[model samples]
Target: MEKDKKIKLGISIGDLNGIGSEIIIKTFEDNRMLEFCTPVIFASIKTMSFFKKHFKSAINFHGINHTDQIIHGKVNVLNVWKENVSINFGDEDVKIGSYSVKSLEAATKALKEDAIDVLVTAPIHKHNIQSDSFKFPGHTNYLAEKLGGKSLMFMVTPTLKVGLLTDHVPVKDVPNYITSELIHEKIDTVYNSLIKDFRINKPRIAVLGINPHAGDNGVIGEEDDKVLRPTLEQIKSKGKMVYGPYSADSFFGSANYKNFDAIIASYHDQGLIPFKTIAFGHGVNYTAGLNKVRTSPDHGTAFEIAGKGEADYGSFKEAVFMALQIFKNREEYEEYSKNPLKKAPKKS
Candidate 1:
């Protein structure tokens, strides 16, 4: 955590059957990435070598059996499993899914134990990763339980940010899930994250309507007038800069989102659809409100282009940079805020 020390970045190799391995090696292939953070990949060195040869990458790695042996300025592959598992590039094997879970479990443990300062996860296929031990919808929900905070699925870029009220929830169930408490909790999470994570002093947040035109004043539905409007009013009464139940259909088309620090959507697709459309391949899916820093590329595993070596590493690379920046931002926020007169560290 020292200012001069590089952030220890932990990586969980997502579904090997997908583009996870390909993008990971591709991102670290440029040795210059090591100058920002010490990368520790939570998969076997042999597995990484197989990927390196398949992708024809010239990236070298520092192999280690444990995290304690991690070396800075090297792509360290900590041996999570020793057996050589067969890989089918585009096939969805449940066994391959288990390996992704193993990698995530080990990397999360390291994060909690302070072995790593931040984590950038590759994309995981949601269906393949379901098991008795790991029965959450996705990483955000699972990490929420593990890290003990009201985790928010915040999809962000430098210019735009969108948070979800209900992620990975079915559309029919989204309405029932939106309650007064959920609004307050989600807005509070976004407000705090903008300040501590992004250095925004006073964040102005806008909420999207749950129903069309926010229920058209009861013509379309009653939830907007009865549920969303009242809840936001209560938040505003508390002296927080919260606005809307704006029509979801026109909010982005009119570029209204640019007016606020962040937007809270009523459901998953309502938010992610616009976010990815605007910032695909450049956005980072950041999990705000968690005690630990976690981020992933905006896109998912591209099964169609799994082994083609045609996958883009821009988002994955951005995820790494965003995690490191947020980690430092949180450190600096704490350092200066905790002590009124703490001297700023000198730049190198």
Candidate 2:
């Protein structure tokens, strides 16, 4: 990745039967998007051609068979599969889900091999994308295993950022997952991401409680008082600006979230529900604390409006822009760390 080179943006076309194709087509249809990064879609041009025609888009793709063939200033489609496949909009098919997995695998491989600078994945269905090979609940977990990091499901926007302590866990099992060690790990991940990825020098973080009223001093629940409080206290003792155990019920409605750079929710819905409500079509689901940068629209496979051409592409476009910015921020952070400025000599 040369500094002068445009970032090789790798795209994983999500569930073909869903609205993934429509959003991707709409986002890149605007030729102005090519100015930021050279996008390489990890699906066949034949498949994409069908989408383009269906959407009535006037966009053309620079079809390539290999990553090396990718050209700058063009929407490049790398043929991950050659066969023309059937498409049924607004339907759930295991075969179609397998193609989503295929595209993701190819793009992920390219990312790991440094053939692509960053990855911006479209939405994928959680159910049909399950098999012996790909059994993860979502992209965050799968990427954490493949890319090797303490991946955090972070939903982000310019004015608000929210990170989940636990994602895709059953409500009954969330408290069991929240422990002293897990709290420390997620807090460290979010803190470091603020500095290195989002370029926040001194990040202020807040955590939401797992119980109603944050346990109300053990009346409602003891986990928040016994677990969350102690863990946050331990973290604050380390001189980190971490504060929390706030009642999740009133934290966001009271506008307390604006006081911190990031908020760590106790679970998935606690964080994502508010995040989507606030930034719905404009938020980016950034997978923080990973060795490589990855982001996706704050959405999922829109089965109801799959091929109606009514899907919104704003979030998808923002995901691309967010990934590019994070890549540059990480690059700059690395350069600064490698060659830090010499400190001024102490006065006599």
Candidate 3:
């Protein structure tokens, strides 16, 4: 790979009924973005046209059947569907749901085929997009199965990084999923992501407890004391810097996460509630531990603001930049891995 070459960023046009196309159009309309990488949007001309007209967007698109036709300076649209689809602005429809899957299907296939370097997925309607094809909870699980890696639903920002042990499961089922082995696997994934993905040297990880006040040391729950305590002790003995079982209420109130490199939450809302509350429109949901780099905006499809042009593009735009940066960071990490020992600094 050449250092000066631009990375090819692939984008899946999630749920057309929502704001996916609008944000994609608005993000590319900013000419300054072309300087970073060429973007290939996997959607049909009809969908892009619907958004461009509805949003009064000014971005120009170069449509082609294959990725080889990608134009560096224009928004490139890879036509996945041939028929002209109707643009149902704000409601969920069966036909639109199918197209969302098709776009993601085509994008992931291209990613595996090496047509694109990184992927930035737009938000999708999880319930509507469910089919025999996409049976997983969200992008993290689907990509984990598709790309062959243990996926971590990592929510990231400039200062904070959080990974989930249970993604998209019911609150009642979270405790059932929080076991010793699950703790080790997910926390190890988070620890590895901190070093390889974020370039953190000797990263420190914090673990969030499941029950209230981390089970109040068995007064409220037994799993935190029996399972988490022993597992964390074993992990600590393995020469890793990890701590916690911290109470969720006080953890965020004082911003205690600032002291660690990463935090492992027992479940989705445990970590994401605070993360979204703090960085709602600015955070990035990174699918770490996959062979390919994939990210999405922290927020979901804004059906209320579908065509209002009121949806903020900050999170999606940040997802794009974060993908490119991670691609570069992986390169540096690989080179560093080859030679971990830094030679003594040359005498000035």
lDDT scores for all predictions? Answer: 0.92, 0.92, 0.86
Task: List, residue by residue over 120-233, the lDDT tens digit for candidate 3.
Answer: 999888888887756866778788888888789999997988888888999988888888888888888888877778877688898888889999879998888998878999
Model 3 worst lDDT run, 10 consecutive residues: 339-348
Q: Which regions of candidate 1 are displaced past 4 Å?
A: 342-348
lDDT of 2 by residue, 22-88 (tens): 8888888888988889999999999999999998999999899999999999999999999998999
Candidate 2 C-alpha error for residue 143, in Å: 0.6
**Residue lDDT tens for model 1, 73-126:** 999999999999898988888899999999999999999899998998998998
Candidate 2 has what TM-score? 0.97
Candidates in order: C-alpha RMSD to true structure: 2.0, 3.3, 2.6
Error of 1 at 318 (Å): 0.5
lDDT of 1 at 180: 93
Score every model by TM-score.
Answer: 0.97, 0.97, 0.96
**Candidate 3 deviant stretches above 4 angstroms:** 341-348
Q: Which candidate do you rate higher for TM-score, 2 or 3?
A: 2
